[model samples]
Target: MSSFPDYYALLGVTQSATTEEIRQAYKKESLRTHPDRLTKASSAEKKRATEKFQAVADAYYVLSDPTRRSEYDVLYASQPRRSQDPNASSNFFSQFANMFAGAAGGSGAGAGQPGTPPAGQRPDAEGVFSDVFEELLRPEVERRVSWWAYLGAVCGAGVGFIIANIPGLMLGAVAGNRLGAIRDAKGKSVAAVFNQLGGNQKAEILRALAMKVLGSAF
Candidate 1:
């Protein structure tokens, strides 16, 4: 009968949202609810914004992490439905922490030895990257293609022929195809990928890529 914050709903994203989507939503929501942005607000408004900001941060911390997100998704699916109350927002982190503690205690394992996710349930880097590319880049490629198609149709056959020969269009097509091919390629282990990079390096790479994708979106 325990209640949990619906991280997906809190972030204004669907359950199937990609990591990039989740990250974008988090950035948007966090900025909107940030206390600094509420300097002119009433005391009650600022307090509400703080609570919402914390909730969004917690949601991003969980959902942006592959393993934690998968575990949470499973737990979320098994829970019965309940309307979220204001108190739930304030207590979200503490409640989630307790749930993890209880899980570890019941498993009779140290926190360092968190139990494995169910078979085939673990999120792999390939899948994560695939989702990122598809969510972030595919639409961009399609949009560009559509724009060119429209321009070609409007500018007559000569311009249409020239547009068809544009290198940017071809490069976009190649990039889109390569992204799918790389993501679909098999045999690389997630642990191996992480091991090759320092922790900070991995984080920086992800952050840089996220920024690049987010920048491209607008």
Candidate 2:
């Protein structure tokens, strides 16, 4: 069963990001893990970088297209992901129609639908999420890491590479300490994330988590 990718999350941009912002973010992010940067990585790591690069590219594509972006917002944002069935990808038009029905009095929007939430008591955006998604799961967002992580890594790599340039005992130390630490940490984080998806349901959540992560990364 096919699942929709969370486009916004992939670009590390927000749903509210403008075209300019999206382009800037893609440009900035694409530079860091570019396959070329994986000069010292094993072939496997390079391949992984290549795939992530593609996901980033795909995110930029859909967001850059106005029509697709609108449809994506309507389908992805308007539709609640947790409908209980892991494999269910609801029909876009059907959800849109449901949204319309809700916009109207929701009395089945003129049918004898018993519960017409009163006009004055109209629910807020939060309620909108409740009505659309079964469980209304707000993404569990953790802290936004400081820019220092990237900066520090860049600084360390530069200093280490320069230090490793000088042959002899110092070079050996840089190779063992600096380069090794970076190699280990990058591999660990990357491996932890791309670890196999267990069951279908877990895969679905992980797929969703990937989007959320990709969004944050950008």
Which lDDT tens digits does candidate 1 get at residues 1-218? 35667878877899889977887786655545444344357888978766666666656656776666777778788877633443464455445554443233232111122222222222222333323234443433332233334443334433434567565555545555544445433344343343344444444444444556445211
Model 1 bad stretches (over 4 Å): 82-86, 98-218
TM-score for each predicted model, relative to the true structure: 0.44, 0.36
- Candidate 2 accuracy as lDDT: 0.42
Q: What's the C-alpha lDDT at position 116 in model 1? A: 25
Best by lDDT: 1
The residue ranges of model 2 lying beyond 4 angstroms of the native Cα positions read 1-3, 78-218
The Cα RMSD of model 1 versus the native structure comes to 15.2
**lDDT, candidates in the order shown:** 0.51, 0.42
Best by TM-score: 1
